[model samples]
Target: MIQSDTIHGIYGTEAAAPPKSQPMHLSMLPCDLKRHWGRCGITANFLATSTEIPSPAAASIISTVINEILENSVKYSAIDTKPIDVELSIRNNTVECEVKNWARLEDATIIDSYFKIIHDKDIEDLYFLQLEKTATDSNNASQIGLLGVMHDYPVTLGCRIQTTADPITPFQISVKAKIYLNEVTP
Candidate 1:
């Protein structure tokens, strides 16, 4: 069983989203991840309009980050029936996005390791390394969504993998990315 302690961790420096942040929570089936991909942008736009410092540019960044996370969630999800839960918290200049879904034990472990490697290694080096790997390997497609967002944006990412004793649904993976809202007027 994956230990409760080992399975949970914050990838970047910040451990939690802002305490007084306003939030928007959403849930949808795994199949809807692609079908409703536009939700990412919708969510982002909501962020832009909701904040005092509204910026369409910030919305774009937030949208990209949200898509990557939702894409990853769909890729690793274990059950079709379970809903993918997403939460967005906006506090001042910070917007935090979290996506959660149930996954098979193996995928859960893989994502957990992915987060650890990002924390341990230089992200740029790993990004280049992953690019090379993706170019050469057909079977082992490198998961680049998470990596690309981390590389391209000024965002902090985190992951939590939980293992349950229940046989029906044994693992759950949650990923969060915190984006610093763009200050430029849009």
Candidate 2:
């Protein structure tokens, strides 16, 4: 599970000095997005071995993040129509996870608008605001996934949109999340 190796360079052990420089990658699909939750387990295990998420507590946090992202992917993707892509990798002490799925054009636009707010102010501030709203009205829990990642973990969230060639339903969205492996708060 821990896929790492030591490689020496002419500079003498420089290339093999630190584990942070060697990143592991894992790509899995939610074969049946509507019924499958294994993708989240796969992601959590991969993160546990590939990154510094060794503690049970740390693993649980990463699992929560992965679960939310994969859930969003499954929720937006056409049921049983396409495989939800989950990619996890680590590089320079930073762990990156990306969830990609095809979504209705209008849904993609709305998701994009939400991601856009992350850039306007401190995400922690926005997260707390959302938390307050959720406390007052349960419906506000709808947007807790990404905001929970920002507030509870040291992660930055981003989104990328690619319109498909098909004019009818043309949006494929990729949501990217990054967390520093050694910087986990708890």
Candidate 2 residue lDDT tens string, 47-129: 65655664666666667777777777766674346566777665565666777887666777667667667667687789788
Clashing pairs in 1: none
Whole-model lDDT for model 2 versus the true structure? 0.64
**Whole-model lDDT values for every prediction:** 0.75, 0.64
| RMSD of every prediction | 3.1, 9.6
Candidate 1 residues 108-171, lDDT tens each?
7788788788888999999999888888889564678788998888787888777777676688
**What's the TM-score of each model vs. the native?**
0.82, 0.72
Off by over 4 Å in 1: 7-21, 34-53, 182-186
Top candidate by TM-score: 1
Tell me, by lDDT, which candidate is best: 1
